[model samples]
Each structure stands twice: as structure tokens, then as C-alpha cells.
Target: MLKVQEIRELIKLVDQSNIEEFVYEHEGSKVEMKKKAGIAVPVAVSPSVQPVVQEVVHMEQKPVQTAALQTETKQEPAAAEAEQIDTSNLHQVVSPMVGTFYQSPSPETDAYVKQGSKVTKDSILCIVEAMKLFNEIEAEVEGEIVEILVKDGQLVEYGQPLFLVKPE
Candidate 1:
């Protein structure tokens, strides 16, 4: 059986990862974890104890509530329209993994790249911190950065576009 602290550590690992589901079994003990809408919930089962289920039922109902609220307020479409950008001709610099996006190396340093900055294929653009490791993201294509898609210190997903660049 896993200790309470171990289980908590596992939960924290799962929550920080890109994994959708994880399962572990040892000597007839089973622990399963699933992530829904970026929320990680763990379920543990053992032969001697009843299965424990923790479900986020409210998260499942949020879409329905949001739809009703959108119709009632009639504001979502306008907000969406205002946030739209033309990306058809831009080259996207995408995050290679799920992590916290940092615009600069540190708090006092300037960002590696900014809008209107010229970059080569090997130019470092930003850093994505995952599991306490800072992975420097590069501009994989030679271009001029047209826009920064995400703000500093934002949580980003794998393959999420980070910048729009006009290829040189």
C-alpha cells in the first residue's frame, strides 16, 4: 500500500504532466489517476478496502452552464471576435511540451525575443519550465516575430502556439 505522502506526491506529478491518465499496480493494489479539463483526480483501490472514487461532477456541468450564460449575456461572441487574429500567413512558434511559459530567463532580464525581433532557426525565443527544468524554446524558422501569443508566466500546453512570425 502506498503511504499518504507518496500518493500526494504522485498526484502532484500527474497534475503537472501532460498525461491524460496514469495507472499503477503493485501486489494487488491499484492506483489510477485521470485528468479532465486540466484537473487531476486520483482513484485508489485495494483488495482490503472499498474502491475510492473522486469525481468532479461540477466540471462536467460547466459547459452547459457556460452555454446558457453566453446566450443570456450575449457577450462571448463579441469578446471572441475581438480576440481573433489573422494567422494564415504567419509561421507559428509552438511550445514543445506542457509547462509554464516564461518570457524572460529571469525576472530582471529582458525577454529572449519580442514582437518585431528578427530570429534565425536556432534563436532562443523563451523558456518553458517543466518539472523545475527550464527548457529553452527556439525559433525554428527564420523570421521576424509578428506577435506574442501568450503572456508571461502563463501555463501552456504542448503544441500550443507561442508566437506568430513572418518568415524571412
Candidate 2:
């Protein structure tokens, strides 16, 4: 199991290195860490990688079948639309942590935003649930969501691209 100091050091490393990914094993469980792919991923508290904390983030599941279907169908039109935009200067939105990322608040709800959606810094684009906490991930720049790189609830690695945003 990781110690408190270890966790803190890990967080420091993530920030200092601009590295987007990290992980740890504790008691019979393994937790992965990642910064938001495009923007830094948010942790509830400044992530310090505290050892033996009550929280652990697991990111090892496949996307729900339904969510995959939704991505496939919805992404086609979005991709078509995105193709029309110039992408040479697009910025990316990355995963913050190793957890289940939900495009919407819940499965039955519409997504918080979609491709072509205009967003600015602080605009929440999605939720990454870690250790039962739903952390809202916000956009850090003004841009258009040109592409979504990860499907809802898919296991995302640290620094994995969640969305590709084309800055205006």
C-alpha cells in the first residue's frame, strides 16, 4: 500500500514533470493516476498521493456497450462536422485521473457538451468519478470540441486524450 508521503510525492511529480500519468498499488487493489489529457485532470484535493488514504481510483473497465454505441453513432456526424474545421492548432483535453469518465451526469441524461460545442476555461465538459467522487473536469481554454478521444466509462490511461479542442 502506498504511504501518505508517497501519494504526495506522486502528485508533486505529476505537477512538476507535466507528466499526465501515475499509478499505485495498495492492499490488494491498484489505482492509476492521470492528469487531464488536454488540461490537467482535477483531483478533489490537491492530489498528494497520500499513503493509505481512504480513496483509491480504479480504471480497468471497458466502456458500457450502450455508451460505445452512442459514441459511434453520435461521433460520425460530429466527426464530419469537425472535418470541416481546420485542426492544425487544436488543443487537447486530457483525462485527470484513472476512473470512469461520464459524458453526462447519468446514463439517461444527454451529454454535458458535444462536438462543436464552444467552451471556455471553467466550462465543465465531463465527469471523472474516482473513489466514488464525481469530479467535474473543466475546459481550460476557449475552443470548440473537435473530437472526443475517449468513450464514456472506458478505462483511460494517465494523460489519455479525452477530447481534441480546436481553439478559436
Number of the top TM-score candidate: 1
TM-score of 1: 0.60
Number of the predicted model whose lDDT against the real structure is largest: 1
Model 1, position 50: C-alpha lDDT score: 28
What 10-residue stretch in candidate 1 is worst by lDDT?
49-58
**Cα lDDT tens digits for candidate 2, 129-168:** 7556788989888988878766888655457678888777
Write candidate 1's Cα lDDT for 40-117 as tens digits: 565555653222222232233344345558857775654465358677888998999877899999999999988899
List the RMSD of every prediction in angstroms. Answer: 7.1, 11.3
Alpha-carbon runs more than 4 Å astray in model 1: 1-39, 43-85
Candidate 2 matches the true fold with a TM-score of 0.50
lDDT of 1: 0.74
Report the lDDT of model 1 for residue 157: 74
